[model samples]
Target: MGTETETAPLELDDIQAGALRGRPNPYAGAFLFLRIDDPQDGRTLVRRLAKVVHPADDVTDPLTQTSFSAAFTHAGLCALGVPEESLASFAPEFVQGMAARAGLLGDVGPNAPERWESPLGSDDVHMVLVMLAPNRPQFEQTLELARVTIDDLDGITGVYRQDVFSPADGRNSFGFNDGISQPCVEGAGIPPTNPGERPVKPGEFILGYEDETGSVAPVPQPEVLGRNGSYLVIRKLYTDVAAWRRYLRENASGTDEETLLAAKIVGRWPSGAPLALSPDEDDPELGSDPSRNNVFLYGDDDKGLKCPVGSHARRMNPRDAQVVGEIRLHRLIRRAATFGPALPEGVLEDDGADRGLMFAAINAHLGRQFEFVQAQWIGDGKFVGAPDEVDPLAGAHEDHGTFTVPRRPIRRRLRDLPTFVVNRGGHYFFVPGLSALRWIADLAD
Candidate 1:
């Protein structure tokens, strides 16, 4: 389950930030989904984008400008003139798409593609352009520039666009802090924020490097086409803030118990404090400290006395906890950001407003990392010794969900957990390395 010892330093300049650590979190951003109306024109747009796309090592520069990342769906690649043979090298799940494989990912009923946004599974969305800026004006400006650029191109069409933002406290609509448990990547030169985290092999999340198997990950050939590239799975998930809050209010006896119940479901406090270290109450100091916040392991809490095994955090990344396979093999870097407005503070009733997250799971080996975790861990409870249980936070429960909280004498079980999260839409994409982007632009088809 371990990778080979140190190789040489990674060529950070050649890799895109999305494939390494991730683009910096901007307060404002937009996701633009596009289609190729004319293959030649689309190629020209790719060529133009290669010049301004951000690289993995650019953040260190004080003068670095707003960031943009580009990724293509299988149809987008085909439209770009990539041969069928090359496309065949891609994982089947990616080629098939998220909605088509919903059963495997455990997305059923209201969460399935049949109920997703109109453009989600259509050929109308061939590529996705992600733009981010620290301020709204800059974000709007970048968005306008791309909008104009796409409009001017005879072969490209803007299919859809979704705006995103980060609230003051950086919490999701559910009012809990997010993006605190991202995995660190080896050879990326970024220090681990969590003391309990070890750098994951670059190949686990980035192609063209040794993976967990100690060999360069297999990729679509010619090497230039696949090198430094990675698979990106994006989803727009709606959070039922009213339902979530109501459940907390009714289940716990008081504020303390309510907060603890929430913590047990997430494996962390609203302030980001891990339950393994602070089970009864939030430790704001620890939650705010990068070194302390994510430092706890589940090994000590196997029975979930400190943190429930079926909690969202534990189900996503069970560090050192008992599992059917090596946890490292399923690691993925989360590049998700909250979308929609936060419910007014202290308001617990339904407002009929749409709110959720624009999630991006970046990984090198899509099958082993992203797909495996979603199918085996997040969608199934068998791994944590709870065969009938699903993730209380994200799972697609058949009838009613049960979350067992380890307590003395008799275990406390939270029953009838409704679907707090709904899948609005999602897709699979291939984010090429900087050089690969250039190669794609220069394609002679």
Candidate 2:
């Protein structure tokens, strides 16, 4: 974001990918996840959507999402009549040559859904782009943009709204701020990663880790580097703020309860001082300050004792854990929103409700960062220290039930963890390039 621009054609990293792939302004939005069904399915989707799609392994090229796919814009939708070849490559300099080809030109409209900035990072384009507008005309214009995207895709897998305007104060259910701590891609500042942590290894985050047998863990064999694509985690988290608040009001917070509990659960206070450093008060200003939001970690303080052993902040990203403990570059670049109805004045008088966050996590490894955080730190009682229970905020599990601790006198235990947050639904989806979409569109069922 600083004046730094790549002289060479920069292939989009996770964070940067989010910035380049969307139309400038959208009134509404949605996060879409797609399954190819099989390897052949993956290949078929590639043909039609190739223009906007980028392959993960194309790390060096820096195109949106490193692949090609349809860009839902009014003009783009209008251009459907144009030749696919022309729209395939958006390089203006090459437009002349592309236009010269047959089946490359089409009718572009007054509003074409083009890539402006994306969620994961700037270099990549988002899978879905929705618009929310002020008036009906605007709505109709944006609806056309959405229509273009819908027409191009296979079908809607799942859809959920994310925001925090009252009823949707927090995540719908997964607990904690879903996209609160993602790392910004080198170029496009996104979910904002750990401040001092080194930039993730070039392809290390997206590509699957190699094993003794040279086989990747999750799937995709021949597409080895294609494994370069990040594993996308989408979860519908419903927040029960009333419940979250009720527990706090009733329980005594040992002076550090209210704020500490929040940071412990969110891994950081609203001010951004990681509980690792400032564990006591909610530095509202600090947490609110973008520059200082994610500034500290386990090492800033001399003893690293500022944050407790199992505190969410420490468990989430023990920056010094690499030096003292075994925590690695477990940062996830999240892109999500808070959703649901706004709490009425009456509800506000009591507490917010029917609100939650839609979590869209992008990471190279699920078993590591995403899953590990949920299991070890959030769900596991033995995360980084002795006798600590799961993360009070994000660690609610089905089989394991609620995990609690007595940080003060060490007498607390997880009571039936009143379902403050609920996991409505979610899944893993792959966002291919625009070219990939075209390939699929041309597919015969």
Candidate 3:
């Protein structure tokens, strides 16, 4: 509880907009991965990017609402000629990269790194550029700006590009409203979405500030490069909508029971209504209200009568509930978006379309935050008293997986939970501050 009362101002102008701000709903965007063939050319592209990237403060204005951000993989930094000592200063998990840690993260079976998209886990992929805007036109404008920086560069080659957009209903591919429980960072100029929700220390997400531990977590070497920067964990996940629908149809007795069962697994309705508050049924009004949607806790539902103890939401946040580890320390700022065509309503047959989500988890400490939550909470359900079970929706489920739905008298257990979400590709990135971008751009060869 070090410095719990101390509030330090964040360098909003130095931090990248994508690091702290959430994307607007009903938005359009793209993720572009580039490979650096030459060091000088990479530096040149970075020099141009320094001017294009927006600071966090710029996002507060409605007029300039577009988000254009850049991040580098460990290989990317090495390609940029970052000094050996400076590169070594980064977190070990980041230095090892996501692909190498696949086993620990439950990225096995069909989701293995060897099966990942081409160049995703490979060293050829250096930098990742993300753009988000309210509409297609604005999105195009931002994309054009990025193109200008790299289109003519002979050394930087575009390896992969995936366009992402929000669905009309503002729900994920699974039909559940996501992005509902982001942590409020203190001094980030954003208020808490839920009443009484304490603002997490800025150091928990940004470097050079006092964190919950009352100390500054280790930053990448050299203050200029690490201060105001944060680590970003990106993963491309493919959702099998048809399979999910088929599972529900087969297990549930009726349409109403199907919906209730789905809610019990996810801990929320498709409308984002938490089961802790609306345990009986979906409430569209309460689900849409930001103040109410994420306000409830699990203290009253210890027996999992409302939201199941091992449900996706309960395992993800826990929210004042009794759990193995401190929930607040493992909080993540999720900036996830849906991509590809939406499966038509009530279709049970596999259409063979590539539809999924681009999940970006931002935090200062990758080990304590993203990796910890993924390994301990989502992959293993022991903390919630269900060791054999995993997150029903996002877990790395095999045909043998089971989900427990706590209910009256005897609890219902779902068996043979097929994997709904498959890991397509991903990597760890260092989202440097604006000044750090310039420093990298101006680095000596």
Q: Which candidate is the best by TM-score?
A: 3
Consecutive 10-residue window with the lowest summed lDDT within model 1? 1-10
TM-score versus the correct structure, for each prediction = 0.95, 0.59, 0.97
Clashes of each: 1, 120, 0
Which lDDT value does model 2 have at 443? 39
Q: Sorted on lDDT, highest at the top, how do the candidates line up?
A: 3, 1, 2
lDDT tens readout by residue for model 1, 172-281: 77777777777778878777877676788888877777877777767767778887788999999899888888899889898888888998998889988888889888
Q: For each candidate, what is the lDDT? A: 0.82, 0.41, 0.90
Clashes of 3: 0
Regions more than 4 Å wrong, model 3: 1-8, 59-64
Which lDDT tens digits does candidate 2 get at residues 102-153? 1221101210112111121211212333232333354455445444644545
Instruction: Report the error of model 2 at residue 434, Å.
Output: 4.8
Q: Model 2, stretches more than 4 Å misplaced?
A: 1-10, 13-16, 19-28, 32-143, 151-180, 184-195, 208-228, 253-264, 271-273, 300-305, 322-326, 342-353, 386-388, 397-416, 433-445
lDDT of 3 at 106: 90
How much lDDT does candidate 1 score?
0.82
| Lowest summed lDDT window (length 10), candidate 2 | 104-113
* Top lDDT model: 3
